[model samples]
Target: MDRISALRNVEDALRAFEEGDVDLTEAERRVAATLRTYASELDGEDDVFRAVGDPAVDGRVVVAASAPAARERVLAAAGIDPDRIDDEGDVPEFDVERV
Candidate 1:
């Protein structure tokens, strides 16, 4: 699957879980699989980029790269506009259990 579709699948699974359509275990499994695919795609790319997101905020994803320009490219690949990210402080703390 393409990166965008993979990301959408993750979002859809989370929404289903939140609506009580699926259990946490099922949600985690689906998310993990989708993320693994997404990560593999990123790995194949020449540039180094890391995709990060917070469970607290739905559909909030950020791509970190070696440089600002590369970061913009990563964000674009994920269909995100870098300007939309107001500030670094907007990113929530990583909550291992919640995520």
Candidate 2:
């Protein structure tokens, strides 16, 4: 769906929660579903990627034009400096794969 429609759908979910029509958990589920739908339907060069390997950045999903950019995005999302090392003094390794 378009960005506007996505926002509207999320707003409706929030409104339902506010009006007590749905519990918080259900509202959260609806919002998450909307986001997943919106992200998956992105146009152009962007594609969804999943991070794997190290636990710190594992399972993170990011939308990027390429795997490298997705790796950077996942690190940023996890709030870990790309150059930072782990307790073992090794830079955390993660591979970004197309979803």
**Model number with the top TM-score:** 2
lDDT of 2 by residue, 1-99 (tens): 889999999999999999999999999999999988888788887999888889987888899989888877887898867677557755558798877
In model 1, the number of clashes is: 0
lDDT minimum window of 10 residues, candidate 1? 90-99
Residue 80, candidate 2: C-alpha displacement in angstroms: 0.8
TM-scores of the models, in the given order? 0.41, 0.84
Best-matching candidate per lDDT: 2
- Over 1-99, each residue of candidate 1 has an lDDT whose tens digit, in order, gives 687899799999999999999999999999988976665456432433443444443343333444454445545655556577677664443311111
- The residue pairs in collision within model 2 are none
Which RMSD does model 1 reach against the true structure?
8.8
Local error of candidate 1 at residue 20 (angstroms):
0.8
